[model samples]
Target chain A: MGSSETFENELTQLLPRLRRFAFSLSRNGADADDLAQATIERALRSRGQWEPGSRLDSWLYRIMRNLWIDTARARGRKEKHEAPEEEAQFVGEDPRESMDASLELKRAMAAMNRLPDEQREIVALILVEGFGYREVSEMLDLPIGTVSSRLVRGRTALLEMLGGSADG
Target chain B: MVEEEKFFAWLDGELSPDEAARVEAAVAADPELSKMAAEHRSMAAGLRGAFGAVEAQPVPERLQAMLKGDGKVASLTDARSRRQARLAQPFWVQAAALAATLAIGVFAGSQLGGGQGSPIHPRDGKLVAAAGLEQALSTQLASAPANTGPRIGLTYRDTSGAICRTFEDRAASGLACREGGDWRIRSLFQGAEGQAADYRMASGGDPQLMEAVDASIDGEPFDAAQEKAAMERGWR
Candidate 1:
């Protein structure tokens, strides 16, 4: 198969996972989708640069992270003082589960939102996306030790936000 | 001899056999060490379980569109252009520009809110989970496995147009639901004592279960009252 076909094929297999990772990072569905689209575009454009035998997901993740950072930088230039208004529409809560699930998830997400961008990114990649420590180090272009230390700190911060004891 | 670092390594299952044996011996002999090890293990398990769920939940439809070539490129380009325009102003002007730009961007972004693309995927007649979220939300609930995670909660559209549930996932995830399909996270409490299997998504006949979640209205789910009533009255 041509490199184009090869890239497309590889991307097709990784699409769902990429989407999930992007969603975790952005939280907003639209932003996550955009990031994924941009990442795929960049990946496909630079398919030649992708070393053979390297993990495709990690490569895509690096590209997605770069795109996300770029978008954040651009968006940061115009950070508004006020909070964005929540959208109006169907806000039907699932009734199957007990009332606690929604409340707990909301609390967690809100706490997660308070984390610094870098720490939040690490948490999303490590905990949310289930990327390995080495892969996260590579994806974020950080040393392995730095990744581990940051994760420890981030997890501690997260625990505190969740109203849990941070020592564990 | 087991060092403090070995605790994290053992919890991560990265300890060498000899090192792991040493740690085990220490834990067996010492109460505090045992407690610490148990707590770490539980915390790790909870974090793993909690994060895993994010991926398992179906992608929302709006996200899907953003991934599509057209929507993303357009959005990026728009944001990029706006940024460039702000850069042209002087330092003092830049401050004012930033504020105005933010206002405009927020207003514009909000206007561009929600999923604009068609909800129905051409290939599948069922309304694609495009707007609020992408993947079928119902599938996440049904496909969740038994003994999967800590049961922090459960949610189902009750007979009163309200969705309600209570519990925590094995990861010590605690959340609650209000309206059917709407979720509100409550508290996230992690602990040292671990005593549960991980939560798993339910699974069976995928297609049938999905259909049931969509079609079956336990009670009037707010806006769908008319349709739900019609169904109850035997919609022809």
Candidate 2:
């Protein structure tokens, strides 16, 4: 396959994940789709800069991350996305699990929005995308310890806000 | 606090074996700590719920078109300026650009080749799995029983509670979720090198298979014990 063809084809397979990650970063369905589309454009334009045989997803993610940073900067502040009234809408919550269980997940989602951008990215990449801390550290260009600390804080805040019994 | 970080990192599977052992010991020693660990696991579940569903949602048609629109795809911020520039073009040029874009879409779709059919096919308008594939699905683990038959990798339940497993043979690769008495082939792609499973995808391989699996799993894939137990019951 030609280089551009290979790049676009790979981009299609990554659409689901790239969209999912974007949803986490942007914290809104509409903005997430916009970011994902923008990321695809950026990745294709800069395809030459990506190293051959490296993880294509990482490169796409770095582009998406930088683009989100630029948009955030242009707005002069981070946009909070979780709305208070929509707390009961988690599709994954089991109705029979418990009344508070669904509410806890809702709070967890809101608390995740409350995290710092860096920590939220860490949480999204690790907790949402299921990537490892080291992969996240490299993607964010942060120290491994920084990734862990942010994750720890993110983890604590999410659980505490969920009203888990044993928060520290 | 340091130990707390390790415990959290343990959830991400970032801890070394020894460090994970320490965290496990600490959690076991204190009921509150154990409860906290369980809560952390739920948070990961919650995280998946909050964001991962976007993956299964359809990609917007406009975004798809814009992606295939230009090599630069025209900047999102410059959409209006680009439209103005296009308006300045002769009618013939605009027509040619649209034609070229459609041609590229057709070519890209052909190249994607996601439609390659599997051994599972329709009979009497109902799709049934390959004959021996069901037995293989229950018994095979991700990295064992190296044989000339179809191999299974990373079993997990979907949001609707179907026990889904990935299988790849020479001709086809796909995810199949266990339905009553048969495996329903959920999603499929085909290629020669498609034997590459989700393992390599996570640990650094082409992510096509893993991405497909990710769209299906409700939470973490089954651990070894879980896999064994699920198999023993014949994916019931």
Candidate 3:
């Protein structure tokens, strides 16, 4: 197959991962799908700019993160209500454990959202997407130390939000 | 000796074995450190599980269609329209239509609303769709009413949050976003029935027209209750 076909195949494989990351960031199925679709569309359009040997996952993630920021900027804000409500609407579950989990998850995300966008994105890239600090640095175009410091602040904020110790 | 700063890195498995061993020993000795480590592990696992839900979701068919290149037409339609039009064209044409719509939306915007002498002025970002597109979107169901001009395919705020529809008159498929009271033509692709297919033609972009239509909302869209309320309010 041509390189184009190979590229398409690779992109297809990344869809599930991309969807997961989008959901983690947006916490809404519709918005997550929207973000993921926009990201894939953008990655395809920018195919020529992709460095062939570079990590495709990271590259795609970088694109997704930037697009998400642009969308947030365009809309001029994010909301606490939209994400969780939409998630609840989509899942349609009444399990008590799941409900408690959702409430806790919402609190955690609300806390994460309170962080500066830089720290939040770093935390997302590392803990959620499983990117190493080096990979995150490259993806975010930040210095390694910057990535490290942001991760530290992000985790501390999260722990505090969860009512746990922040000193860690 | 393990440095205090190394614990997060160690917990993340980024440390060398020697550093990890030191951290493990410290955690074993300090109850607080051990508790912190467990908490972090639990949070990480919780996050992993939470994100895992999205992975388990079936990728919506519309998304798959987009990936396949021909799905734009398919994207515009729900299952019903898809069934109706399935035999009509190849996927490339659908791709072409979708691509063409975006291309036109880029340069020839203000076609659907907000143009001089046009009936609708884009009050904000939205397109009042003149009276025409608004009514069609609101009431006209299957096709454009036989007497009226063309109709875009099924209209909805798709999963992407855009008010999208396919125009029977491919030229009329341009979209307008509603801002406050007016509609601004973000882009226009094809022409509506018999009118000039010239991408430049715009209906009167009138501010009053949008008001008369009662289309734009300041807050969340009407839920079923609000929809009923609006009907009772006579859509004023």
- Candidate 1 vs candidate 3: the lDDT winner is 3
B14-100, model 2: which lDDT tens digit per residue? 778998888778778888878777777876786687565567766656456544633221122233222333333223323333443
Tell me model 3's lDDT, rounded to 2 decimals: 0.54
Error of 2 at A51 (Å): 1.6
**Predicted candidate 3 versus true structure: per-residue lDDT over B1-236, tens digit per residue:** 44545888888887899878888998899888888888887776666555665566566565565557541222322232223432332233234344544565543455534445443334455445565555554444432233655553323332334443323343345444433333345445544322121111111111112121223323233333433343343333
Q: Model 2, residue B59: what's the lDDT?
A: 69
Error of 1 at B168 (Å): 50
Q: Which model, 1 or 3, shows the larger TM-score? A: 3
In model 2, residue pairs whose N, Cα or C atoms come closer than 3 Å (at least 3 residues apart or on different chains), thus clashing, are none
Query: What interface RMSD, in Å and to 1 decimal, does model 3 have?
Result: 11.2
Task: Tell me which of candidates 1 and 3 scores higher on DockQ.
Answer: 3
For candidate 2, the docking band is incorrect
Runs in model 1 lying further than 4 Å from the true structure: A1-3, A73-77, A80-107, A163-168, B1-6, B27-40, B58-236
Point out the worst 10-residue segment of candidate 1 chain B by lDDT: B195-204
Give the C-alpha miss distance for residue B203 in model 1, angstroms: 34
**lDDT minimum window of 10 residues, candidate 1 chain A:** A88-97
B122 Cα displacement, candidate 1 (Å): 43
lDDT of 1: 0.46
- TM-scores of chain A, one for each prediction: 0.74, 0.76, 0.75
DockQ, per model, reads: 0.06, 0.16, 0.14
